[model samples]
Each structure stands twice: as structure tokens, then as C-alpha cells.
Target: MVLEGVYKVRSIDEVVELLEKYRENAKIIAGGTDIVIALRNEKITPKVLIDISSIDELKSIKDEGEFIKIGAGVTFTKIVESSLFQKNLWGLYKACRLVGSPQIRNKGTIGGNIANGSSAADSIPPLICLGSTITLASKNGKRKVLLEEYYKDKANYGMKEDELLVSIDFKKPTENRVLSFAKLGLRKALAISRISIATFLELDKKGQVTTIRVASGSLGKYPMRELEVEEFLCGKKLNERTIDEAIKVVQQSMDERLKGRSTLPYKRVAVESMLRESIGDGIKFLDGVRA
Candidate 1:
């Protein structure tokens, strides 16, 4: 039942204090895009609505030494519009650009994307590929977890009800990093992805590919890094045979849960093409064929 509970709080400290006081009864709201729907569907019924949307500290993105720290309130629209972010993090920018329509992008945030942890989320795969970290905060203190390790137990990971996801920190890519993000959805816009992929490749001064990370979303119970595929590509040259070998490695690593999904047939074929195209784009970037 949608009973009228008095919505409360206007600041981060107030929200934190209320959460510390109410714990499981208090819920944080950023854009409330997903949460509102969950509430409408009777999936959750928090006694207190602590609006952190007004909190200034949680709405900025900045450089913090080796990482780019994106506050919880930073919207997808801002990500797509930022010149610095686009220049340095092409995969992330591309992912951001594909998120929802203009209205949704303006209201949806990176932190909200992470907190929701939905398998079909556009931003999570790239974040996982970039080796991001999430900062979860509460009145008690804060904890940081590697984005790749954040998901667990076939779709269940423990997060305290009182904790607020404060920020996501993506370690800046190494100089000359080649990254790509791709999604195949039912429609061009405002469509949940049937399959999505994110790839990152870093090469040494000698032109040998040193580090590779690939992650796939909407293909598992949780968005996951393709560690086995990445390991296989470590010393391999950027060539057709190597990319095909990497795709084979990806297919082998896919969990049975993914294989059982409805999109299996399309995804099986599409994912290989996505991987090939992404690796080709990476090679082009490395070879100075495109920026």
C-alpha cells in the first residue's frame, strides 16, 4: 500500500544522521529513477526518505591523484558532456551517451547505476573493465571495494540497508590505452541491452599489448569481467587470429546462467562480433588510424 510517509531530510549530514538513527528504515534517494519504481511496485517501503539529491558534495566529479572520482549524484548527461572525461575515458563516455533518453540521462547517476546493480545497466560493464572501485559510506565510516569483486553469489551481494553509495573511482587508464564499449539492444535508444561489452587494452612502449580487460553485461546474473579472456589476450598481438582466440576464450568463460537466457542464440553470435569490432577499434587506436 502506498501510505503517505513524511518525506524527510535535505542534506548529506542529515541523511547520514537519519540513517544512523533509523538504519534499515531509512532509504537514500538520489534521482529515485529506479527506487521510485521499486517503491511503486511495493518492492521496498522505507519509513524515511532521505533526499541526498540536494547534497553538493555528492554531485561533483574530480581528479584524485591516480583516479577520477565521480560523486554519486553526477548524472549521465554530465558524463556525456564533459570534454575531459570524453578525451581520457572514451569507453565510459560512450557508455554514458547510450544511457536512456535525454530526460533519464539528466536524472540518472553513476552512483545510482552502481547501487541498483541491475544486470542490464549500461555503465557497469565499462566501470568493471576500467577496474573501478566503489566507495560505500555511512555514519559509521566508509569502505571501498573493487568494482569487479563487488558482485557475488549468483546475484546476491551483501550491502547494508543504511549504507549510501557515495562515489565511484575509476583509475585513469594508462597513456595510450585503447578502450571500447558496445551494446546491442532492442532499439537504438531507451532500450535495455540484449548484450553489452566493454574492452580495455594497454600496450607497452615496445608496442606489445600488456594489459587487457573485458567485461560483459546483460549476459550474466551480474555484470562481470571476462578475466579468463583477458588473461588469454595478455601477450597476444592485435591480429585477426588473436581476436578470434580471445572470443573463444570469452565463450568458454561464460557462465551457464548466461547460456540459458532468452537471448542466448542472438547473444552467442552477437557477442563474438562485438568483441571482434571492439578489438579492431582498439587496434586502430593503437596504430594511429583513429583517435
Candidate 2:
């Protein structure tokens, strides 16, 4: 690849200043996992590469009392290693842990995964399920957008050509709430996700679903919240009958969303087991609490 200049920025201001100067002609590079390949293939040609890997402002994971904040430049390996994500937030941990191979995880940042804009990005569904929000910084100013809206309405909510994503944050769920995730891949080792599900749920004392957010990857034009399935699941208790019926609800939604797509048939069948793992685990955890 031909580059007029490469800059390793030390602060957020430096990154945005370069982005402001180069605008569409500049590209941000962190892990360089995906962008490097794109660069090599000439799929994207930018006159400048702004490296943010060394920016301390973009490499932290903090528990900010009411919510958790993660810098955009924090890598999957860092998320996997962070103790904050080991409990109720384990879904985020599992998704990051399962992204590609060890080498990729060590270098791939959560912000880059979303920026890559692949429908199959493993980190996204879980983050979406967590009701995450991302911040964008530019010479103009900084703005925070709901992560889901940013993905679905990119033309409107997406970062401008001169903006940089700074960090992502989400409120902390109740201590007993469960955020579970499961994915279907060619192999468990290093396969990219063919399909993935993440469920953030809380059950009432009598085991009825009180709150739930379900999201899936590779199920649409982008990774998004499965609102139809979530609507079907709420107020209903988790069980074989309810779960079976909920799976059918998912199929119905996909039928309309992916009508003529070739991958629909395979997703229709594989989702049963995938849903069982993502949602059923919450049931098991709640059951154990009652026992």
C-alpha cells in the first residue's frame, strides 16, 4: 500500500486533528487486523493512516459506578482479561474471547470490530444486547449515539468522515441478571461466526421474564437486536413450551427479513440450538438460584 504519511497519535486530540485535516483521505488504524488486509488488497486506499494503538485515552476499561466504560482502542484480549466482565457481563467476555484466533484477539479492538461493519462481527451482538452506546469525537465536537442506532442508521448516526470513535459504555445490569451468548461456526477453534446470538435477560422471583434484550449477528444487513423474538419472550416464563414457541417467532421474523436469501434455510435450523444456548442458560442460572 502507498501512504503519504503514518502517524502514531498519543492523545485523542491528535487523532481527531489528523482526521479533521485528512477527512475522507485519512484512515484510522488500531489493531490493524482487518484494515491491514484491506490495505494489502487495495480495497481501501487512504493517503494517511492515523495509528491510535498508543493512545492511553483510548486503551482503558473502567467501572464508572453506574456504568462500565471501555476505550475504543482496547483489544479483545484486554476485554477477555478484564475481571469486570467475568460475571453478569460474561457474554461480552465470551464473544470477545471467541473472535478469530489468539493472535487476532490480542490485536483486534472492540471499536474496530464495529467499525469494520461486518454483519458477522462477533463482538457486536453482545454489545448490542448490553444496550451499549458509542462516543464519536471530531473537530466539530463529541457526540454519543446508541450503538444499535449507529449501526442501523449509519448514514445519519454514523461518525462523520472527520470523526473518530472514542469509547463504548453501557449501564450495569442487576447482579443476578444474565447476559448469555452462543454462536455457530464452521469449527470451534478459529472459525468466523456463521450465526450468533446474545441474550440479556432478568427473571422475576416467580421465574417470569421481566426484561430481555436479544441480538443476533449475520441475521440481517447488520448485527441487530431481535425485537420480534424479544417481544415474544417477555412476560413469558422460560420453559420448553415457551422456548419452542419463541424459536418459531424468530423463524417468522427471519422469513420476512431474509425471504429470498440463500442462507435462510441453514439459519432456520441452526438457530434452534443457538437460541437454546443463549436464552436457556439464563433459565438454568435462575433455576439454580431458586434451588
Candidate 3:
């Protein structure tokens, strides 16, 4: 695909100005891992391209008081290397580490992954489990939307034509909380996720689950929390029995949602092991933390 013009933006204001002027005709490029492929396949034909990879304002990961803010331009490799994520957000770190290959991870921006709006996108399930929100800015103003709500339609995310996603923010998980991720792909290296799960679990002093959030990707139109499974896990001990029941709940939910789909049989069976591994990892991590 050919673009009419490519503008390297220096700041968010410049990006907004170009977006406002070009509207639907302009597309923002950061890392270009996703956009470049779309452009080559003629899936996206934009008259102008605004490159934001050089904007320093959108590249830093900062630790705010109650939450951590990840700049939209931050790459997956940066996420993997960040001590903050490595030390606390293991689920997100693991998901980032598993995204594509080294070169792809080095160049793929988290914002681009979210904006691409693929249900199979690796980072989204973990983000949803974390209760993340994204900030979209325009010449008009900025608006924040929950990550789960960003996808208003099957093929379209709710971002306005003039808006540029600037950052993703989520509250920091406390010591009692543990997050874990598991994915099934065709092959180990550079694999596109077929089915994946991310789980956020918190345990009380008695080793019973106090809070739980379970999210899956490549299983629906968009990544979503398995609320029924979450409800079943609450107040339950993270033992083999609870794990089995949780897996059953998730399988039942998937069966209801994907009854007639060809992939249902495989997915329903695969999801059980995925959830089991993710929940088991969370339990192990919590045990290690307490020890």
C-alpha cells in the first residue's frame, strides 16, 4: 500500500493536530508491526501516516501513587525488561515475553496491539484481568475507557477518528494478589495465540479466594472476563476440588457461547487445562510470596 504522506510527530499536540486535519484519512503508526502488515495486505489504506514512535512523552512507564501508567508508545520488549512489571505484574510480563519473536516484541507497541483490536491479541486478556483503562486524546479533549469496553463492535474499536490512544493505566496489585497467564498456540516460538487465559486471584489468611478475575482471549468477539467462573471461585479454597469446579464453570460458559462453532470441542477441552495452569500458577505464586 502507498501513503500520500508520512509525518513523524514530535508531541501529542502535533499528533492531535494532524489527526484533526486528516480525520479518517490518517492512521497513527507506532512500531508499525501491525499497521505495516495491514497496509501491505490492503486492509488499511490511509492517505496520511502519523508516526509517534519518537515522541518521548509516550514511551515511559511511570509508577503513580495508586496505579501504574504505561505510555502508549512503549514496546513489548520494554514491558518485558521493566523491573516493575517483572517484580509485580508477572501475568503481563509473561504475556509480553510470549508476544511474537524478539524482533517483533522489540518493535510492537502495546497501544498498537490494543488499537488493532484482534481478539487473539496476546496482551489484552491480561490487561482485562488487571482492570486496565486506556486514555484516548484528540484536539477536542481526552477520554478514558475501560479496556474491556473499548471494543464496541466485532470489527471496530470505539476510538474516534480524531482520537489517539495515549496511555494504559491500571491499579497496582497488592501483596495478597497474584496474576497468572496461560496460552495455547500452534508452536512454542513466534506462535499466534489460539486460546489463552489470564487470571487475577487474591487469597485471604485462611487461604480462601477473596477476589478473582478470569479473562480469556481468542474465545470470543473480544477478550472478556468469565464472571461465572469468577463467582464460583470466590470464598473457595484454591485446592484441586476448587480448580476442577472452576474449570467446569468456564467450560460450561464456553459451551453456551460457542455451541455450534467448529472449534468448540477443541476449545472447551483446551480451556480447562489453560485455566487449571493459570489458577495453579497463581496459587503457587501466592504460596511462594507467603513463604
**Residues 79-196, model 1: lDDT tens digits:** 8888756643787888889887899999988888888889988899989888888887778888888878888542344467767888888778766886788888789889777678
Question: Where is model 2 more than 4 Å wrong at Cα?
Answer: none
Predict model 1's lDDT versus the native. Answer: 0.79
Best by TM-score: 2
* CA RMSD, predictions in order: 2.4, 1.2, 1.7
lDDT of 3 by residue, 38-60 (tens): 89999989999999999999999
What TM-score against the true fold does each predicted structure earn? 0.91, 0.97, 0.96
Give stretches of model 3 more than 4 Å off. Answer: 152-157
- Residue 139's C-alpha lDDT in candidate 3? 96
lDDT, candidates in the order shown: 0.79, 0.91, 0.90
